[model samples]
Target: MKAVEYRLPKEFDKSFIVFKEQGLYFPCPWHYHPEYEFVLVNKSSGRRMVGDHIGTFLEGDLVLMGPSLPHVWVNDQKYFEKENTETADAVVVHFLKDFLGENFFNLPESEPLKKILNLSNRGLVILGHTRYQITKIMNAMPRQNGLKRLSSLFEIFDILANSSEYELLASPSYMENTRDMYSDRFSKITEYILRNFHRDITLKEVADQANMATTTFCNFFKEHFRMTFVEYLNAIRIGHVCKLLADRDKTIISVAYECGFNNLANFNRQFKRLKDMTPKEYRKALEAEPMIA
Candidate 1:
């Protein structure tokens, strides 16, 4: 159960680097920089692996990733189907944590900002009004220079620091072990779980796949992923349930069985626990959304 490891740069430069990516889907290999990253996904949809957090990311998503956290954005294969035609754009701003210097946190006036950055240790995903503001700022960043760029970058952080609508994605363990095992372990475990979630997967089974003892695997999994093995499995099942609910042809009972629940009652309970809604309610909500091609 090796964890993904990354190296951080030594120096903390005050300036920010702006990157504009076009037609690019897959992110850089699992890696981390010493500098904090503000990412605005103008157009893209795919799975994002940030530290131990895993989830689907849609276009117009905005996130603020803390410094030295292993992360990658994997684009959906559909994006590459036509080869040269697919175009996805992203604006990324990277700056050193010390860019604001020691006084940034020392000053009482900056307490709120410090609190937000501190919260980022657990990994934050900005949404709602704050995300919209950050996206606008990031979109304008590449066209600006010097003091203007600096101001825009600070404004983005200010939005993040003050927003209550954001969500924490990564677990506490991910915050503690910024440099964990190797990237292959994460890929291996993720692929295995995705393939075998419909079947009975025990701790021993997963540990065997990683060539580690069951106990060691549990500790490693919990440390890096911030959840027990069973909890992670349940989350995968719940995600599958969401997909099934969105399909009009699948009945709730059939979906529960298909998702590997042994009993309908247990499935209903778990679904409600994870989703905070009954299966029917979840489907109704999806039905209300505009269809995606």
Candidate 2:
């Protein structure tokens, strides 16, 4: 997919940009920049694309991405409805590798920090205690400026440097071959899928969205997504279905239909293939736990 370039606003007084974002829809689009990014989503639920990785993102999501890594978080359909008042809120930090100094990370004391920055080129999701700690710091970032804010940035870095509670998002292959796909129609195709995935979607329809033949588009999608188009769509649907299953008021059949499954039998089969459990069993498991998906 061709990713768009995003220009982060300049702030000469600050060593890096740390700010809060709040809007009916996230101001972000599918784009990239030259600086590394730290994003913490305090309020929002949506689909996030990091390089070639596409997955569900919910409130409290935290991700770190290296320079020029293409990514975006597309808000769910509910955020787009005229009647919905909920806003997408996040704290984002952007800084260059040498924002501290040209050779700061090269110092012996900064080995761990250097290591994580290398890993972030593929994008990383900060998780567990690390996520919680970082979330607290991100919330206080805007309220504190100058040296205090800079120190908080270091505090987050130290947590990341020592902790193993994280996962890489994009594949090594995607990072290595980004030059070849820099100008692509993949983003256009994904936007179409996000808008229509609540109902049936076909390969032919997606191919048309990309203005490519079905066969050609399928091959390209598999290379970037690590799965076929149908596999990707079902994965997205099942993600939402899991959330719906948490609601005891909705029958499993209704949940499946709402998530785009027309055939009950097919839905059951697909659900099992992905989650290793049938829809009814999955519902029962969640109902017992009493937690949101």
| Top candidate, metric TM-score | 2
Whole-model lDDT, candidate 1? 0.70
lDDT of 1 at 222: 90
Determine the C-alpha RMSD for candidate 2 after optimal superposition of all C-alphas: 12.6
Candidate 1 clash figure, as a count: 2
Candidate 1 lDDT over 105-137, as tens digits, reads 657767777667665665788889888878888
- lDDT against true structure, model 2: 0.79
Q: What is the TM-score of each candidate against the true structure?
A: 0.58, 0.61
| Candidate 2 lDDT by residue in tens digits, 2-117 | 45788778677898998888999786666889998999999989877676455679999999998988788878879889999899999999998788899898788898787788
- Candidate lDDT scores, in order, read 0.70, 0.79
Instruction: Give the clash count for each candidate.
Output: 2, 1
Residues forming the 10-long window of minimal summed lDDT in candidate 2: 173-182
